[model samples]
Target: MIFVLGMINAFAANPAPPSPVGRTRPPPPPPGLPIDENILTMMLVALLFGIYIIYNFKIKQKTPM
Candidate 1:
């Protein structure tokens, strides 16, 4: 399956280095995201509220002909 091929490729891409005492080196820390967490959360909430207001004003149908 595709999952098996992906796993094989992942292992091949980053192989473990040989050690005389059979010990491996620790991995480096991961890179950070583009935006700060607080700003990202605020932007997401604003976007959701804007979408809700737009949907209610422009998309919703009124009752009675």
Candidate 2:
């Protein structure tokens, strides 16, 4: 009973913030890197690889694999 009511309230609740003027917000500034999606993906991949390396060395994998 309570679970169903909670679910109904959750679904009925407002999903977005209320704005009187309903003006659309401006787009965010681009990253400092190149303006291409491929370059952005590559940069993110490299960053994740570097982070994984650091995490493995610091936290997990006591011995080098």
Candidate 3:
């Protein structure tokens, strides 16, 4: 298409500026809580407890006379 060719020519005419070299960025902030096996175990236990509660409620609802 003419539009596509025109766009390609326009981009080719102007190139992007070169990036700065040897720039040192600041280090990222540390996490609030340390992630270890204890944290992982707690999360897994909470998820299983929530699933157990929901399953029991559904079973109770389906047991009508």
Candidate 4:
């Protein structure tokens, strides 16, 4: 299908490059707000909540009048 071919082309065009051959350290977060595991957890929870709301809306729309 055209969609499948497009996806393949997209992936081929944006292939991830290999990492540099040297010692690497993670960059520090911004000064104001520190990005830590807690922030990541909250973001994940918010994302899941958004998905749940959208799913509920779709289910309600599908029910018989």
Tell me, by lDDT, which candidate is best: 2
Question: What pairs collide in candidate 3?
Answer: none
**What tens-digit string does per-residue lDDT give for candidate 3 at 1-65?**
99999999998896775565765875568887766849888999999999999999998886658
Best by TM-score: 4
Worst 10 residues of 4 by lDDT: 14-23
In candidate 4, what are the lDDT values of residues 1-65, reduced to their tens digit? 99999988998896676676663875567698566849888999999999999999998886668
Model 3 lDDT vs. the true structure?
Answer: 0.84
Model 2, residue 15: what's the lDDT?
A: 87
TM-score (C-alpha) between model 1 and the true structure: 0.34
TM-score of each: 0.34, 0.34, 0.38, 0.38
Query: What lDDT is reached at residue 32 by model 3?
Result: 77
Tens-digit lDDT track of model 1 for 15-56 = 677665855766678878755759978999999999999999
What's the lDDT for all of these models? 0.82, 0.84, 0.84, 0.84
Question: How big is the positional error of residue 24 in model 3, measured in Å on the Cα after superposition?
Answer: 45
What is the Å distance of residue 3 in model 3 from its true position?
Answer: 55
* Model 4 bad stretches (over 4 Å): 1-37, 62-65
For model 3, give the 10-residue run with minimal summed lDDT.
18-27
- Candidate 4: C-alpha RMSD to true structure equals 11.0
lDDT of 3 at 18: 52
Residue 28 displacement (Å), model 3: 30
